[model samples]
Each structure stands twice: as C-alpha cells, then as structure tokens.
Target: MSAGLLVAVLLASALLEGSGWAGGVGDGNLRLSVTVNGRADSDVRPPEVRVGTWVVKRYRLLNVSEADLHRVRVLDPGAPAGSVRCPAVLPAAEEAECTARFRAVAGRHVHPVRAEGDVPALRTRLTATARAGYAGVAGALGLTEEVVVATPGTGGGGASAIVTYTVTNRGNLPLYTVRVEDPGLALAPGAPDCGGRGGTVAVLAPDTSAFCRTTVRLRPGTYRSAGRASGSDRATTLGTGGERVTAPVLTAGASAVFVVREAPVAPVPRTPAPGAPAAGSSAGAAGASAGAGAAPAPGAPGALARTDTGTGTGTGTGTDAAGRPAAPAAPGAGAAPGAVPPGAVPPGAVPPSSVSPGAVPPAPPPGLRRAAGVDDEGFLGRVRRRGREAAEFGVATTLLLLLIPAAVAAALLGSRRK
Candidate 1:
C-alpha cells in the first residue's frame, strides 16, 4: 500500500482494538501531519498505529494565540465525531496546548453521523401528543351509534324532537367498547357495532377515528344527560360526562342516563250533557263567570286557564310556561366541557369515581439514563465527575491535550530533515 493508504489501514486497526472490537492489536505504525489555520502545527506525526486489532492516529495542537482559543471540538472528519474543550484557557503568552487523534468508529454506520462535538449541517426535531377516551375508537373496524329518540308526538306520546348523537374517536389510542351510561342513550341492535362484533373497537390506533350515532328523547322540562363507559362488564367507569335534572343511573358503574318528561295533563273543556249537568260542569262555568265578573278578579291562575287537556307544546319557538323561549338548557355534563353543562350524577351513581386525583407513572429505565455529563466546577475549579466514564476518559483526554503541542513540534522538525 502507498504511504497514505498504509497510514489509513494502520489507524483503522488500532482503533478497533482499543475499543475492544478486536481481541489484540499487533505492532504497527504510520504517521501524518496536523494543520491549524493553514499553519503546520505537527510535523510528521504518527498517522496510524495498531495497538491490537484496531488502528488510531496521534497528533497534537499548540494554541499559541494571544486570545483564549475556543473551538470546543475535535476537527475529525473520519471519526465518530467528538468534542474538544480547552481548559488551560491559553493565556496571552502561554506555551502551546496539546491533543491527540484517533481514526474512526462504527458510528459511521448511522446516516449523517454527527458524532458529538461535530455539528451536522442538517438537524430535525419532533413532538407528539396522545390521549385515550371512552367515546373514541381504538382499532375497531366498524362500530356505529344509532341515536333513537322516543318523545311526546304531535298529538300524543311520541318523539318530540330527533336528537342525533355522533360518537367518534378523535384522539390517539383505541377504544374497544363504548358502554351506554346516559340514562336515555343506547346502542342499537346491541351497542351499535364495530364490524359485526360489538363492544369496544378492535383497534383504535393513533390518528384513527370512528363515528356512531344514538337518538335522544326530549320533553317539556329541562333535563340533563350523562354517561360512563367500561371496557368489560365488570370494569369500573373509564370516563364520564353528562347533563342536569337527569335521572340516576340504574347501575353503579358504566351506565347511561336518559330523561323523560310528561306535560301535566290539563282538564278538557266540558259542556253539560244535553239533559243532565256533568259532575263539575256547573262549577266550571260558575268559576269562569265569576272570574270575568270583575276585572279578571284580583287572582285565580289567569282564569283557571282552561287547562288544555291536549298535549301542550310550547308552540312555534318552543317557549316556556311564562311564554319565553326556555333559556337554552345548560349544556349537559361532560358534554365537551364549557359547551354543555355537566350531567348530574347521583351521590352514589357515577362509576365509583374510577380515577384518583393523584396518580403518577413509574420512573425511567437504566438504558434511558441522562447523557454523559460533567458537574458544577468546585471552588478549586475541579470538575465534578458525573459517573465512571467521567473519571477514566476525562483524565485520559486531559493528558492528551497537554502532550499535543510538543509531540507535534518534534514530529515536524524530525520530518524536515528527512
């Protein structure tokens, strides 16, 4: 091999051995030079030396400038990237400082290896968030909600309004099943369905979403609605949200609340039988006549308001007993906080308060230890050792810094004569 090629091979071999990559390094030697700002700092320095099975290069640096030279990095292009920190602070008239060099490491296998101290030209960063919820689907294939409302109909008891519920998974993580907790909400044909199998979704993977619907029955008075879910029949409540004036859930855990209201039936107007007066016919007529007798007599329920025995619906704009549009019902509990009033859960109703306020995850693993580090310098300027490597590598690298400038000079001077 040519001098350059031989030098490369020897250096590579020495490194592998030193790193324990090889069992032993046979004797080998080759030399190279060092330059800083175009000035040759080290004359023919040993370019490559095999200690065992690996190769390495030894060179030095002499910071003779007036200012404190700070590059905090080893200028190695063919190495696993490394950093260099000058401790001597190169005082204006101080002698040269020193450092040595090694060839490379397996880190080169990683794409665009930055190898510490060696800053890369390109860098990237990322962030993410995750949440698990009841209404959300996990890996489910086909589950759906079918809102079915039963209400007071146009003339009698029936569906007053058609409320559609669309349950969906809009966050990361999957949900296996969405239990029915709302008193009135329910999953049709067996908890809606995920594919053909009901229960939770099969896989509500990250970024995956599913939608289901359920109908709600509404009545005259204001009522709240809320529900809780469970993964299994015995599982405690997993999540909760709902509205007010709602009925208590039948079961303690994973039950839904539905509301039912019946308009007070009014007594119908009665005309006396053609020949015989009905039981209260005479009394009813007398009361009406008496109320009109004076300026609608001081009091008496707006003239006993002929209680319309008919189903009394707040006509048109659905107003209230006072003829005012019932102020929109407070949002139901857990209905998208802030948007819907929380549904009321009886004292012993909601799933036994599933989660406690204070809970924390476990600590990290050994492999996830903090990066190798140095601690606060003490009063004497001695760096506090972080761990084992700090003690060994820290000292070795320090000595190399001290020997750099001298070895470099000797190597160059010796080379000139050759």
Candidate 2:
C-alpha cells in the first residue's frame, strides 16, 4: 500500500480490523513500500516524440521495515511498450534504485499506458502522469505507522555501528521472525571493515528485546529509521525507532584509536639588554696582549686574543702562527673561494695524508653516470611515445597482413548474399 492508502487504512483499520491489534496484524508489523515520480503526465504540450528516441525513467524503493528486505521487485507499466528490467529490491526499510529505458519513435503515437504488480496479497499500482514530451508523475506506497520513530548513530576508522534494538512482546501474541534491516554506512577503503558488506546485516530471534548492531563510518547527526516485525506467516511493519551519530575516536596502535600527540614546542626569546654578551660562549675575559700595553677587550673578546690561532709543525715539531697543533688548524674553511691550489694546505695545517683513514667508498657501477642533458621527463615521454608509435605500426601491419586482405577477399566474394 502507498502512504496515502496506508493513512486511509489506518483511519479505518480499527473498524475493519475489529478493534486495534485485534485484527489486521501483518508480517511483523512491517510492510515493504514502492514509489515512482518524474516526467510522465504533464499538460504543457502534447507528448512530443522522435524516431528511435530513448526515454530514461528513474525509480526508488524504500524498504521502510526493520528487517532487511530480500529480492524486492518493481514492475513498470510503460513496459510492454518496450521497457528494460526492474532494479533489485532494497532490504526492509532500506531503499534500492533502478532505471528503465524506453524508445519513442517520431511520428508514432502511443495509447495511455498503466502498470501494476502484486507482492502476494499486497498490490502496487502505477499510472502514466506524463507522455513522451511532457513532465512525469510521482508515486509511493501508503502505510501509516501511527507511532513515528527515529534513531541515529556514529562511527569512525571504519568501525561498525553498534546499534541495539529492543524487541518486546507487549501483547500476548508471540512474535516469530524478529529481525533487523540495516542501511549501509559510508566507509572508505582503508577502514577495518572496508572489504566486507557494511550495507545490510541480518540478526533474527524470538527473544524479547533483541539487540542489533551496525558499524558505519562515524558521521555527526541524527538518522531516521523505522522497523517492522512479524511471524513467518505474514509481512507487516511492527515497530520503529531512531538513532544519532558522532565523530571518530582516536587512540593508540592498530588495535585501538590512539596517536600520541606531542606537546607543541615554543621558541626561546633572547634577552634585550644593552651590552650583555651572549650566553653559551666559553667563560673568559679580554685582557691586554703580551706586547707592552695592548688594551684588553671586555669579557669574551679578551678570551679570543689569548687563544692559540696556529699549529706547531716546524722541523721535527711543526709550528703554526699561534703555535698550536697543525691538526687544529682549519684555514681552508676560512679561505676565500679559489684562493689556494687544489689540495694545497695552509702553513702548518694538517694535510689529507696526515688524517686518520676510515672506510673507502665503493666505486660507481659501470654505467651509472647521469645521461648528459637528458631530462628524466623528456626521456620517459619520448620512450612512451615511441612505444605507442610502435604499437600503432604493429596494428597497422597486422591489419594490412590479415584483416584488410581478408576483407578484400570477402568483398570479391560478395553478392553471394542479398
């Protein structure tokens, strides 16, 4: 029944059912629903059509039952006039979509068409609201559930939605096939359950207040849901509920949601004093030079003048300008670019021969040099284009060697048909 019919039935159910809950109890209190709408019956102009013209029809079906629907069917009336197939049925309360294709030939006319189908005793009706050239019509099943209910949930990291359903037998009648129909949750490839069906999961029982759980990628908002329960004898919607969802939770390792968030680092500001020397330098003061009376600079400035500036490598005992070990000198680091010959050392400075040897690096493989002036992108592109050209040539050759000649021979032997 469509929503309109459902409302009418509900208003008069008490009379027909012989008291509410006394008669008219269906499959679990859930019944499947179907709806269609779009450019079918509009009166802007007469339905216009062309030769070999094609028309696309869109349809959506919502299970609207707590139990997942299996093998639902939708029959379109415009069919025999040349129609395609019906999309599969959605699970209980869940919805499935299907499209039908039709051809309209120009200068041709069609009579008003209508469609109908039967789900056992439940009957569905479809009628043309628009023609080939006009807008379409809208339709749906009418089953008014007195009590409106909704439930929403959330998940993250590809976790299944944990939904719990309570099926209680408030009345004396025994509920036979108590089940749940779940709409799929949005999930990405990397999620834990990505490879499996997050669409519909079924759990059936006769227990009072049964629980149903589903893990969907967590979204933040409210979700609307309705359910139907019944015995094996019939199909009717019984009860419905709603739920809400929230954001993902982050934790540690693969087993749980945990990522250790380190505290942010802060910059250390320098002191803004007049003449205070910088910290972290060797602790010393600038005193007078050994000569007569060289005024000593203050603090650290005085310390540098007193330190050795040269190596000692003269004769058997090499000597530097400051008379320190030759190994201590690093004049090349301070030398102007190109000031010294390649491999030449400053006076008393240690040469490469004097340094301690470590491991020698292996030589380059035989053909490991960069291709001269050959940019990687340009080279790769050319190679790819050459391969494509070769492929084209091969195809051309094969066609000339096989297909074309065969086609020519076939043509020579033509007129045998017709």
Candidate 3:
C-alpha cells in the first residue's frame, strides 16, 4: 500500500481500536482504516495529481467482537455522489472492505468513511479519514555534455591512420551503452579493440567519460576525419581530426653512351725499290737537298734507319738453318774474327775450290746499298723525289733528271768513303 494508506491505518488503529463501547466489556471494539489511491488517507503529505484525475479511497472494517456481527454496512456519505461500496453482512471476529472513488475537482477537500454493525447485545460504529487535493507535480530532466579528441597517429604513405575519441557524459543521469563514430574514418576489418568502437560501455555516469580508438587504411591523398559520440541520442559531436598520405620516390645511378666517327689515316711508307739509296745515306741527303740544295748530311738529326741482312756469303752468312735471313746480328755476337767454331767460312771471301771457275757473283738487289746505319723514311723520300723528277723530265727534260741523278750518285759515293 502507499505511504498515505499505511499512515491512515496506523492512525485509526491508535485512535479508536481500544475504546470500550458497552457493558464494560473489552472484547467488542471496532477497528477501521482508510486509504486513497493505495495511500494512507491520514497521510499528512499525500502525492498530488491534477484535477479530473480519479481519487479512489478504500475503507476496511474489523469486527474485533466476541460474537458474530449482523447486517453489516459501511458508508462514506461525505464523499461525492455515486462513490461508495459497503459490505452487507460481516461476521463477528471477521474483517470486511469497501471502496469509493470521485473525480477530483479543483479544490482542497477532506472525506470521512464509516462502518456500522450489530453484535449480540452490542451495537458498533467505526470511522476513518481520506484526504486529497488537485495540485501539479513539478521537476525537470536536463542533459549537458563535452568531448575530447586525441591527435591522430602518423600513417606512412599508403598505410592506415589511427585516431582516438573521448566522449564525456556531463548529464544528470547515467548514459548506457555509449558508442563512438567518425564520419570520415570508415570502420575497417582491423580496427583496434580499443573499448568504444563497436563495443559498448556499461554505464557512463554523469561527469564521467570513455575512449574510442580506431585505425583505418588510407590511400595516397589528403583526408579529413570527424569524431562524435552516440548512444540513446543520434550523436553528439566530440571533435574533428585530419590525416594525409603521399607516394614514394626512386633514383638511378651512373650510365654510359658511345658515339662513332671516322679518323684521318696517315699514308703508309712504301718499301723503296731495291736500287733506292740506303736509309740515312748521302743519296737520301742529296735527294732531299736537290729539292733545295745543301741538304743536311746522312746521319743528320731526325733521320730514320734502314735495316740490313747479310754477311757477303748470302747462303750461310746471315741465314738461319731454315734458310730465312737471320735478323741483323749485333757486333761480337758470332765467333771471334779468326776463330771458326766449325764448318764456318771467314768473312768477305768465298773459297775458290767451292766456286765454279766462270761463275759471276750475283748483283745485290737494286736499292740494297750497304751502310753502318740506315734511314727507312729518307730512302723512301729519295725514291719519291726521283719519281717526281722522272715524271717531270721524261725524255724531254733529260738534263734536269740527269743532273739530279748525277748529284744523287755523287752523294752515294761520298757516303761510301765515310
């Protein structure tokens, strides 16, 4: 029962439960209680509801007598019309209950309820009170909040960015099943298990908070992230954050390239005809001089050498065993002047016994002049000059050709003397 009804019952029992009614007897007393809307009718402070609300009151009667009660009846005549229910017969030592309700009008009012019955040689009357009023209930439910956001962690190029959100419930009531969200940060397969993502919080009491961390993979471009908290309401904005991404760089080292072009070729020196002057000899000097006269002598600076191969006896002299001319031998390389090792001939002569009587020595090839040292280019130069002159004179300019030849011959004879 309501506090009002319980209070009303206690008050009625304290006031009238012990009063003796007839014949000095203590066994036939009446006890009564009254309540309104399950609350004690005698409560000093009853909960007030607006007008037109029903005010239901109930009255209970206990016989408390030695013998049976007859023709029992309960009444609340002080209540509004059509608002009473009384029991017709209630036995002695037994209890009975009745109820009444009235549409509350705009006023402060008090109502009295009563019970009456007859016991053997005793008559009885019981009474209680119910109070009600038309007043309004007043109170308010208000909510306020705050949010904190953590800076996002660095995400390497082509990697995921991570952000954290802390949502605080600064409301008067506890918030249940708190959740967090980020519009720009999509939920990913590998999002961290950091408390508030897809998870729930049992309670976020007033002035308390929770954290939600999320990780997402981002492509190579600048992006923005916005954070918020949600539960019973749509969503309260926590804060906003940002993330950026970039690409990679590569480099190559040294390299090479090639180009092609033709180069001028130096004229190769031609071998002199066999009769051309020995290299570095006066014939080459004379030829060189004939072009300008008074040329420097044989063996002059810058003269090139001609190589020679012989020992007078063309067969065994400078020939190797296979009969090829041996490379020019240095001095002191063969047997000493007069000391023949074996099967050797002396230099400068052939034994008459080995020669046929009428046989003539073979003439040396045309340009094969002997010299201590030779000039290959000088010999070539002399041959070139003779050719140029012969071309110039032919048989008509014989004197010019004759003079140059005679001059070259003289120079050759002079070089032989030296």
Of the candidates shown, which would achieve the greatest TM-score relative to the real structure? Answer: 3
- Residues 183-204, candidate 2, lDDT per residue (tens digit)? 2223232222211322222322
> Which 10 consecutive positions of candidate 2 have the poorest summed lDDT?
247-256
lDDT of 1 by residue, 1-418 (tens): 5999999989987675454324221111111233321223212321111111122222233323222333222334432344322233333223333332332221111111111111121121111111111111122122223333454534444354333323343323344444433444442444534344443344344345543333444555544433333332111211111111121112212222334556445568777667775685888778868967774311222422122222233341245666655443322311332221233332333321343457553343443323211123453444344355587988999999989988999999999999
List residue ranges in candidate 1 displaced over 4 A: 1-167, 170-199, 203-208, 212-222, 229-261, 264-272, 275-418
- Runs with alpha carbons beyond 4 Å of true place in candidate 2: 1-47, 67-71, 106-418
Show the lowest summed lDDT stretch of 10 residues, model 1: 110-119
Residue-level lDDT tens digits of model 3 in 113-211: 556666544344433333332222211112222222323244323444556556565443455555454544555433534364363455666667665
- Model 3 segments more than 4 A misplaced: 1-28, 120-418
| Cα lDDT, model 1, residue 338 | 22
Better of 1 and 3 by TM-score: 3
Number of clashes in model 2? 74
TM-scores vs. true structure, each candidate: 0.23, 0.19, 0.25
lDDT of each: 0.34, 0.36, 0.49
Instruction: Give the candidates in order of TM-score, highest first.
Output: 3, 1, 2
Error of 2 at 130 (Å): 9.9
lDDT of 3 at 169: 59
Q: Give the TM-score of candidate 1.
A: 0.23
Clashes of 3: 17
